[model samples]
Target: MPLALLALAISAFGIGTTEFVIMGLLPDVAADLHTSVLTAGNLVSAYAIGVVVGAPLLAVVGVRMSRKHLLIVVMGVFVAGNLLSALAPDFGWLVAGRVIAGLPHGAFFGAGSVVAASLAREGREGRAVATVLLGLTFANIVGVPAATLLGQDVGWRATFLVVTGIGVVAVSALAALVPYEPARPQQSLGRELRAFRDRRVLLVLATAVFGFAGVFATYAYLASIATHVMGLEESSVVWVLALCGVGMTIGVAAAGPLTDRAALPTAYAGLGGLAAVLIAFAFTAHITWVAMVMVVLLGAVGFLMTAPLQTMVIRFASDAPTLAAASNHSAFNLANAGGVWLGGVAIASGWGWTSCALVGACLAIVGLVIALTAGQTAARRATA
Candidate 1:
């Protein structure tokens, strides 16, 4: 693996920390900003909205720049966002800062995916892409939990400040490590945009959107599930979350190797496992040991779908993948919002928290169906 991959991973660490740390500190942030928890919750939505709006746009804006410079510029935006967040005076400022921080996230990952693919030997692209995703996966285990602890002890502002430092380091690393220029020719804006028109590309993105929805639906209500359903102490929730992160880390690690050999099949296996886990989780929620085991399996199986989905989309895009690649983040964020909204609806309708698992399962089934269609279509095309 290229050392440059490490730089990408490090930046992912900071971005992941800032993105999720807010979830754990919503109450503290709401208190500090003198706003209701609902408003504070909007801060999280603000960041997602930024990613949804910015990923393709920024990829286009940064499209002309060399991949190395674009990555650095993206990191600069991330750093500035965190710095502003650390010093934000009120809720509005904090939301602005988070939006700024999130804007470059998908673009950076998209560009990095392209660069990593270029750097790797033939047939090793999946592993390289998985290596880049490892940063995001690892963040759950290390960055989010650590930041949560820091936020609790000091203040949420300080947590963002720490993330700011991490971003600075990442920027420095990118500057030192990545090549000054990309080896491949740049794709035109029109060419990048055309990728959306491809049937396979659209299907893959849909698969990503619906497939990951299951993960988020169950995940969004986990804290509630822990306290109300499982009867765990509030203090224990963090560690259990951490345990899930451990599963994520493990899943990402295995995904790299498995995806390298069989990309679509790996995704099928992951989606299947994830769907099964989510359904089983609903019933297992009240069982302490079962819940813990299920959480880990859920994390593992959910993230296992990531690298293959990226690989499929990039491949489907063919001549111009940058925008399609970047847009996956948009798809995932949309899934996040959809999953949470549907899960909330379930709970509000007296379906209870466990209903989220079934909702997620249904989503996974939708994704699996799409993937099957995509696979069969590809086979026909290949033989035709």
Candidate 2:
């Protein structure tokens, strides 16, 4: 891998850390801001909404700009957003700042993925994307726990300040390490929108929604699960989360070569594996050792789908690879929001946090069904 790609991975690490570390610090934020925990939770939702809105918008506007220049600009937006978050006076302002911070999240990954793949040998595309995503996985393992600890001691705002500093480092790295390229031929916003019009692209995105929802259904309430269900102390939750992150890193790393070997079938297998693991997780939660093992497996199997789903979308919409690739992140954010909401409803209705595992399993099965259906359709069309 080029040194430039390494820089992109580092930026991804910073971005992913800021994105998820907030989850661990939500209680601190709620207490400091004098808001209900539910309200503080909306900060996460607000960021997801921003990702949904920003990914396509930024991809369109950025179509004519060099990827390197666009990455720097996006990181600058990220820096400004995190700084605003650190300085926000109220819950509303914090929410606004989170939204601002989120605007570049998807676009950066989309363009960055392209840059990563473009820099690699033709057959190594999966390896390239995996390298960038490794940073994201590692953030969950190392970055979130460290930042969450910092928030617990110093204050949640201090955590945001730390994220701002990470963003600054990323911005500097991107500017210095990533090489410049000329802009692509000008394409109108309408041309970008056309990517959405394709049914295959929509199906692929739906796979992301269902697949990612399965992961988030359990993840959104991970702290609760750890404390309430696993009989672990609050501090121990961090270790459990780190375990999940370890699983994600392993899973994502394995996804690349598997995806290159087999596309949709590999995707279906991953989705099915996630569903099976999640079902086991629900049953295993009563025992800490069993639950811990299941948690790690869940992370690995769930993340294994990332590269395959992303690559599938790009293949299905090969002409608009940038838009399709970027929009996968939006689909993921949608899943993030939807899964949390569904899991919350389950908990509120008296099913308990373990129910989230069951919910996630169902969602994974649904994703598998979609993938299988798409496969059948393709097979029939081939015979015709």
Candidate 3:
């Protein structure tokens, strides 16, 4: 693997930490800010909103820059967002900070995947993208839990500050290590948008949107699930998250090899596993051991879907690999927002937390169906 992939992973570490650390700190943030727990949850929603709105826009804005310089600039934005979050005086300012921090979330990985593939041998693109995603998977296992603890002990503000430091390190590493490829030949904001005109490109993007919704639906309610379902203390959320992360690391590492062998089949199998795990999780939630096991499996199944999905999108958008890959992140983040909103609706309507699992299962099945359609489309195209 290229060392530049490490830089991408490191950037992913910071981004993932900032994105998820808030989940563990919701109670503290609520108490400190003198707001309701549900209100503090809006911070998570706000960040998702940012990712949904910013991913494609930022990708387009940064489309013309060298991938290396663009990454550094994105990290700088990420650092500033975290710094402002650390110093936020009120909830509104914190929301603003999170939105600012999240703006680069999707674009960075989208563009970074392209850069990673560019640096790899031709047929190893899936593995290359998986290498970049490793940082995100690792963050769940280590960074998020550690950062959550840091916030609990020191202060929530300190967690953001620590993430700010990580972002700065990523900025420096990217500048020093990643290769500076010249801007894409004839690539422009308009040309990038043109990639969406392809039907297969649209299908793949939709696959990403619906496929990842299952994970987000469950994840949005994870802390509550820990307490209400598993009978765990709030503090145990960190450990459970770590268990989930462990699953994620294994899943992500395995995805590259699996996709390299059979991309669509690998994706469908992973989603099927994820759907089954989530449904089983609802019933297992009351058992500590079972819940722990299920969380790990959920993480594994969810992450295994990522690299192959990216690979599928890149292959589908052969003419505009960069834009399509970047847009895949945009679509996934859109799933994050949509899934969470739908999950919220279920909870708010008195369906209770277990409803999240049911909702997630349904979403996964939807994704699986779409993947089947995409597969058929690919087969027909190949024959034609």
Candidate 4:
């Protein structure tokens, strides 16, 4: 991997930390801002809205800018947003700051993937993209936990300040390491929009929305399940989450090389494995030891498909990969929101805590079916 990938990963790390650390600090934030914790929870939704709206919007806006320059600008935006959040006077200001910070989330990864692929030695593009995403997986393991602890000990404001510092370092790294690549003359809003017209690109995006949703369905409620279903103490919830992060890192590391060999096949295996793991998790939740193992498998199988899905969208939309690539993150964010809602619905319906896993399994199966249909259609098109 190029040193430039290190820059992209650093940017990803800062973004990931700021995004998730808020979850742990909601109580503190609510206390400080004189608001309810439930209201503070809206901060998370605010950031997601920014990501979904900004990903493609920024990609299109920066279509003519140099990739290197665009990356730096977005990271700069990230730094500013974190700084604003640190100094925010009230909850509303904090919410706006989070949205500002999130504006660059999808855009950075979108352009960063393209830049990483361009810099890689031939045939290693999948690995390069995965390397960039490693920062995000590692963030779950290290960044979010550390930041959450920091927020608890010092103050929630301090956490954002530290993240701002990380953003600054990332901006400097990107400026120093990434090579200059001028915008292609053929690249335009029209060309990028056309990429969405391709059936393969749409299918791949749909696959991401549904496939990754399965992972989030269980993940969003894992703490509740750990306590209610698995009979674990509150303190043990962190360990379960950490173990899931470990599983995510392992899965992403393995996905790179597998995707390089065959993107669609890798996706097929990942989605199939995800459905199996979720079904197994539904049955195993009552067994504490087995439930922990299932958590690891759930994270692993759920993330295994990410690299291949990202690679497929980029390749299928080769003419305007940036927008397509960025849209992939937006799709995942949609999955996040949708899965959380569906999981909540299942629980609210009087089903047990483990019922979410069954819902997740059904979602994974749906994703697998879509992926298979996309593959068969592509094959038919090629044969024609």
| Top model number, lDDT | 4
TM-score of every prediction relative to native: 0.98, 0.96, 0.96, 0.97
Worst 10 residues of 1 by lDDT: 178-187
Better of 3 and 4 by lDDT: 4
**What's the lDDT for residue 227 in model 3?**
93
- Report each candidate's C-alpha RMSD, comma-separated, in the order given: 1.2, 1.6, 1.4, 1.2
For candidate 1, the lDDT comes to 0.88
The sequence of per-residue lDDT tens digits that candidate 2 reaches over residues 209-325 is: 998899999988878899999999988988999999999999999988887778788789889999999888888898999999988898899999887877767666656567778
Extract clashing residue pairs from model 4.
none
The Cα error of candidate 3 at residue 219, in Å, is: 1.8
Task: Write model 3 residue lDDT over 222-330, tens digit each, in one string.
Answer: 8789999789997687888888889988998999888888989989998899899999998888898998999999999998999999888777766566667777887
Comparing 1 and 3 on TM-score, the stronger one: 1
Per-residue alpha-carbon lDDT of model 1 for 134-170, expressed as tens digits? Answer: 8987888989989999998899989999999999999
- With a 3 Å backbone cut-off (N, CA, C), the pairs that clash in candidate 3 are none
lDDT per residue for candidate 4 within 276-362, as digits (tens), equals 999999998999999999999887888898889888888888888999999999998888889988988999999988888899989
- Order the candidates by lDDT, highest first — what do you get? 4, 1, 3, 2
- The lDDT of each candidate is 0.88, 0.86, 0.87, 0.90
Query: Candidates sorted by TM-score, descending order?
Result: 1, 4, 3, 2
